[model samples]
Target: MLAPSEVSPRSLHAVSPMSSPPSELTPRALVAGGLIGSVLAVTNVYMGLKTGFWESGCVLSSLLAFGGLSALARRGAPLSPLETNLSQTTAVSVGAMPASAGLLGAVPALTFLGTQPPGWAVALWGVGLGTLGVLFAFSLRRRLLEEEALPFPTGAATAELISTLHSTGSAYAARARGLWVSGLASVVLTWLRDARGLVPAASLLPSTVRVGGIGADGLLLGIGWNPMLLGIGVLVGPQAGLSILLGSLVAWVGLAPGLVRGGLVQGADFASLSSWLLWPGVGLMAGAAATSLVSQVRALPAALGDLRRLGEHGEGWESTAGQWASRAVFAAILLTLGMAWFAFHLSPLYFLLALVLAFPLCAVCARATGQSDIAPISPVGQLSQGGFGMVAPGQPGLNVAAAAVVSGAASHTSASLWSLQSGRLLGASASRQLFVQLSGLLLGAAVAVPTYFLLVSVHGLGSQALPVPTGLQFKAVAELTSHGLNGMPPSSTLATGLAFTLGVLLSVGARGKLARWLPSAAAMGIGFVVPAYYAVTLCLGALVAVVVGRLRPSATQTVQSAGAGLIVGESLLGVLIAALLALGFLQPPG
Candidate 1:
């Protein structure tokens, strides 16, 4: 890693504007960005709905947009470095737009509510919430990116890639080619497992392997080909990867078998196992993340002070261009409140409470995202649900949906900042980048809202085939808060408490002396909710990353880069496959 430069605090830009000649944010750049962002929005939505997590689009979008735009430039296009920045900024912003309200966390929870609003309402919510996220984040650009110099890793990476592309385009071709190969391989692997149906899955196993009443399939012990899971594991690094594996063992070997043998759980199917197990996983993760987030509250005063000072000085917050930005933030939020109250028939009082909680939560999400690329959005969503479960009791729809208002904002705000960071590094126009970001969000919503319904039609929400894990967690929290432990078995409740405590201890310990050895509490907790097969694949990927890092540290970046390619390729292919399935052009193997 390059050492931190002792850049002056007044240097708001990551790269000097005079470092190289600035290029136009051309019409071609805007269109390419919108198109790329739309495609990535579809891909990430598809991937996230399936896995309950998503890779950041900035790096992938930067690489792809630069290459594609550069190729066009060689022929007839007039793309410039700043234009590539504009394109990437737009792509990352809009591509993840739907995630603010529709894809990952909130809309899917509506499936569990069993009474969803019409599609158009949801589409509008995506746009409004997404825009609010950008507005909310724009105000903090100076505080977080400029004054704090927080390492938005993915943002930095994307910026570095853009800088590389602009300085010398030929050097990028090798990395791009490697990315393509991994992506193609990932698509083929997914096809073989799911569509081509090459892999044989058997429930029965020999006596030695089958312990208690749990069979091999019951434990989900067999490996399944999912390149995306593996790639994600590699990106997360070894500690997190190993933690995931450890969590998988805790579930499949101990929890799954024990539940079956003790007659606590009724079935061995994926849905049956995951539904019961999700509670503890959700709790563990939420509890740990909540503790960590609350601790950051201590630093808020200093950060806020810095922000105020910047505004006072006119060098940071107060600006000729972004001065009226705060007004826009208020307007967008007010519009969001109105939309929530009228369109969805949400209680104005209850929705307002959610809105009040959103700003701080959004800040925390940004802090977490800046520090580590992992945004603990699911846990934060649960935190919102738990808070409001009592505030708006027994109203599952309001509970999940209202929380979405904040979690969505928090999540997308950090996402937009990631894009802005890239823009900063490339010396792109901040105001114009903001404009493209908002525009990309609109484009993402247009594409993503429709894709969501298509996926729902093909796989059906809440099904094992396309389990929206984040939504399920939200649904579970809503139910748990409203019902308490009345519906659950005593053992289940006890187990959940134990897991939660374990999560607390682990996280707190990590914060203290045990920081180095222990795995990420969040990753470990996630293993409890997802299918064991996913954990296995993730572990495999992590294992590969670890081995390579140990044996050949220099090539680790190359491998990780390739892994990223695999993620993008598989996601795009997955979207295509899902589309074909929805259209009845491709029959999923019966």
Candidate 2:
């Protein structure tokens, strides 16, 4: 049924036809990517822990790399498009370490379960799992990216941005200036609020609102003075942002009071409410993600065909898996299984089962991300947990660890494919990008592993400051699997079931034109887990973007750059604040 046009080799180079290979994989590009990735590694750990959302560093990294490299190029060698892609790819790889390392979810869930994994164990586990995912990307690049012609919107956007930046001399400088100006402004605002105590945590809101006998503070309703959330709102657009807002209002304003009156929630604080709300939230996310994955079943055979023909093409490492690529993949499997055996004490059976399941799950993740820009990372982990719960039974630790491996691999697979999508458009060497991405993985683990521990030590997991909502979902799933709803409130169980059904229905309805008008179940689920203020700010950010676009369409990208700067600026500042608190230079907020 496949068309000859789809399988033609020339289609691979349709975007960029070069007479000679460009200057890619340079030491400067690698170093630039490594350094930027180190910062992103730290930034993402802070952002992921606090908000349960991590930004892709590609666009921001592209601008930064271009700005820096272009500056130096004026006096020396010129920068090439492929070289910039390599740098951005490397930076994204490093920045994505927090998720791949399980710091955002599973590993933190372990700590909550009273098992603190050593830094070395966590690092090794991340590298092994991430390497497996990267190998999957390597194997499927030609098929998914070249043959299938998946949109990969993020990659296309990045590629377009790169071409635009390089085409005009001043374009990069202008965007870079906007990025840094907004970033520096965010840094200043964060310092004023967090460090110097000059700004209130929530700027524009009433202190409290009383519903019946329950008094709700603006902060409790999730209104806060955080630019990062607003920035996220801008990036995600109106549909998701508004969905989150609706979810927040429904969860906090509508549900919290009823729970308080029912004596289900003992207090109006975030911790008290989220403990009960997370059940329904987690259920909704699970249902929607499950539905989404099932929708991709039709593509499995094609994905498998690609997997089967991974090394058959004789186009070297770019289009085919040559001897070196095959050896590396085998090595990656060994490293992953070895880490599973040594670090988590997972038996070969469980590890291999997870490995087998990961291919389909990661394939679904990649395709889903390409089609809809949603990676389903959390859903992938929960699915793993459910599988292991049945197989292992009564071993919550094993369930959590197994889920961690699957999610970690999925995360890396998604990230790798995104980079490869851009590379294909730029005619960059897939082999070289793979090498750079792998290097970023190592560098990120090295820098971010320590930073994760430091932030946890200072902020404390499950605290109001670092709620680690994603981790709580993982923890909730593991516990539920072990105990089977023993001691759960009857009301909470009813709510969870209803929410799950609703999520499934919404997901089923979110196809084609209806998708734009429908509420995003995943965003609603996230809104239920995180504080309400994040939703409010995210909506506001989206509003700003919408208004700006209508006023001047040309300024849309500038707004996005500014929003990205806001996120990066505040995230890096949060990390710095954590370090200061750890070193006793700054006191914890009273």
Candidate 3:
């Protein structure tokens, strides 16, 4: 954690163009950063849709964007201090937004209406959702960013990457070479799988290997080998990763297999196994939300105050005559919300109800979670969808989808605020940070929409699609509404809820055995919900982290930095490959 007073105004002063700053960022650097960020954002979102870890996309995107920006900034270029910081920060933040597109579009689209709405409707929802996120986060800028001193782990890694690049300028060349090489390899591999229908040659275990007299299938092995996801597992730590893996195993290997053997689930492929994994994953997310809010309640007021101050500052910048312009923006936001309803062909009254519901939900959730900055805006879009869903059960999908977008916007806003505050604490300018963040958001959103549609088209929708390994998809969840909530067995719900509750208790209370092992609970819960293969890979990551932690106890920061780099690098490469394949510019080898 860092404090506002610890950040000096002098630190925000732009570095002299003559003297090479710690990181000499330039236009070229910005371009490179943007490209990398875009790739990471796209891939992460793609994977998130396949898997159920929506947050992973944003986290990985930020990391990769920062890494690329830092690497480029290390090389000497004609850039002032503010330019360097703003460019790097903005580039990374932009990547975070695209990963959120599904939430911004698909969730709301499906939730407010019965089917997928038009692109314009989705876009308006995205804009309003995004704007609200920024506004809400702005309110808490002071408390979370300035007073709490919570270490912006991702931001710090970015800063360190920049420093490392500056110290060894040649390192940028090495990283670039690595990125291109890995990217080409991934692209080629993916193309071969898609076009030629070629089977991957590599195998972690023999295809014929049997477990408990059951012959292992190629699909099982293929599902198990998600390198990009494994890399993320390493970053999330052994405990959380292992938990997710275990959950997957229970669903895919234990439950799905057992059900099939017993003649209960009849499908040859058991595609519905993915749905089983989703139940717990969703529960975990809900639990996390509830628990986080409860824990952070004390900080709510301060966070809200900071946001209010920021709004005041923005208003004060203009003369009284021009103050009306600010009001016009707010009015515009309202009109846009109305337009979204019209575009979706929904009743205006229903739309108004959604807005009314959003106000309190956002505020209350934020206050509960101690993330007042994001809470203020997140609930509006989601609650609106929920309200609409209740009123129009025929269109539950659209309503739920809308809710997910609201969640993403809120999450993104919080992340941005955190990043900005980190920069401020380290002596960066507030205005510059804001500019960079806005730039990143716009660029990310522009790229995300097409990328999302492309993935759905290429991979297929629902359970038929190739999973993105570590990503989550709200639209897919929304689709589940067609089956009804009763689709989830009561026993399964109870079991998952109990497990999650016990985990939280262990984390917050109990001591000895439970406490010592508490760190692993999140992973286990996640594993219980994900595929067996993913859970296995996550476990591998935990193993690696544990080993590293033991080997260099004094280098925790270093280990974390390196781990962050691997996660971001691999994830970014995956997204870029997907994008290139979609564009027909790069073909995977058949």
Candidate 4:
């Protein structure tokens, strides 16, 4: 039998009793949320395509909404804290959708398969699938939030921030100040690095760091002084950052030169080299991920049990299937099935499997986020491909597309819970928050749909300007497996097998005592995939944080906050530059 405390409504992060009813979710606020969400969603797409990572829309949305509401307050009327939460809840739901790993990452990868889907299809597909995610999130809320009490660090931070900001309208000043300073610094540095037309470029380091006449690039190199990477490294922590470094060294130093010298590969460039190197890196990472999941098989049944007992509380949307929102989700999922069949040519069986898989995959993604604030989403899509390909073989397009839907839905599903967790803590109406999230999704689709196609039409999908790593992965795996392994290159097959074996051993070996020294197999795999410049710059940030955190542990939050500001700053500016270049307002700088 379960303990009473385990199933109780009480929580370490539960809402306090309120004296007054929380402020209303007004039309103006809803519109504001949608509009803001659209901008953020566009930014997300731009950044995701550039960096192959998507930062949370929560903190940034909260910060922007609070500032806007505060500014409006100075003039005349202002939003209450609850209203702010509603607005932000809406913003994050929509903001994270457009450039979602599932849609922008997995779907756009179809370009490699000679299948470039239209923006309307992508948009409709995203909104429909994302709606299912929102529904999945709420249904899991009772277990994940109330009973099980997962940490959900981002949600907690946002909740505390909303409470603090509303209660005293003062703390935001320091955080905002930190945000802008770093943001502006990043913008300036990016312009200099990208647009400053210097001969041989404005590199912060000297040409060579020669050790025994081999040169560090040959010996696998040191860190780069890049702001965006530094920010990510700091955010991901030293261990993950270092693992990326190790992966980069193994690929570039230990592997690349030998491959080139032996005439196994043609180019030494990041883009060229990642094609071959990332195979093993991805295999290693994928193998580790699969092993980690398989190792936890005993816990699966209990999680499913917790999930099925969702509405036992006899309250909220889950308990009442009569709710319009509930019906909307059902309708969306059903309609999406039709869309998949006619538009995407996916089979009906794949949709059923995607739904069944959503329960477990969604749980995994949400729990992962709650624990580490990182969601390994692409693997879910990959897993979907692997699972479906066996039962229904040779339909590569259908398999990958179905996987995209599942992963895409899972993305929104996990994200919605986090967005609403803050709202619930702030005493916003559950129905209202749900509505806001849905509205944001619709608005995000409006913006993201156009932005995606525009970027593709102007810049091209696989272009160096936008080297979407996830898209490449989705494209590669779908084609490789579905098209038949017998037709694959001999070298590629050997490399993948070797990499998979290496990944399994290293990951499995990282038990108990050996954990800290090894770093994340996933991060190392990413290091193999992305540019050396990215990994190098990230190391710099991680190194700085490690050094500073040890010296001044008290100020780590402030520093991390500033690092976040740098990321947003650089991302916004980078998008602006990309847009300008696309429109012919600015020519290629380098």
Find the candidate with the highest lDDT and give its number. 2
User: What's the lDDT for residue 200 in model 2?
Assistant: 70
Model 4 scores worst on lDDT over the 10 consecutive residues at 1-10
lDDT of each: 0.73, 0.80, 0.49, 0.69
In the range 58-109, model 2's lDDT, one tens digit per residue, is 7888888988788778887878887788999999898888899899998888
Clashes of each: 0, 3, 44, 0
User: Candidate 3, 484: how far from true, in Å?
Assistant: 7.5
TM for every model, in the order presented, reads: 0.91, 0.93, 0.74, 0.88
- TM-score of candidate 3 relative to the true fold: 0.74
Distance (Å) between predicted and true CA of 185, model 4?
2.0
lDDT of 4 by residue, 263-318 (tens): 66675555556677757776767777676665546556755875665434445553
Model 4 off-target regions past 4 Å?
Answer: 1-20, 27-32, 76-79, 99-101, 168-170, 193-226, 302-322, 371-373, 457-459, 487-489, 505-513
- Sort every candidate by TM-score, greatest first: 2, 1, 4, 3
320 in model 1: Cα distance from truth in Å? 4.6
In model 2, which range of ten residues has the least summed lDDT? Answer: 1-10
Model 2: CA > 4 A from native:
1-21, 203-208, 317-321
Cα lDDT tens digits for candidate 1, 1-590: 21114333223234466675546578778888888888778777877887776766777777778888877788775666678778888888778766786577677777777766667777677777777778767777777787778878777777767667667756476667768888889878767766766743222344357745666765667555677777887877778878877887887777887777677788877677776787777767766866776666765665455345432325542475466665576666766777677666677787778877776677777777777666766656777888888877777788888888887777678888888777666566678887887877778778888878887887788675577777777777788887777776537787778877887888888877778897776777777777677777778888898898799876765677677877777777777778887778888876
Error of 3 at 166 (Å): 5.4
**Using lDDT as the measure, what is the rank order of every candidate, best first?**
2, 1, 4, 3
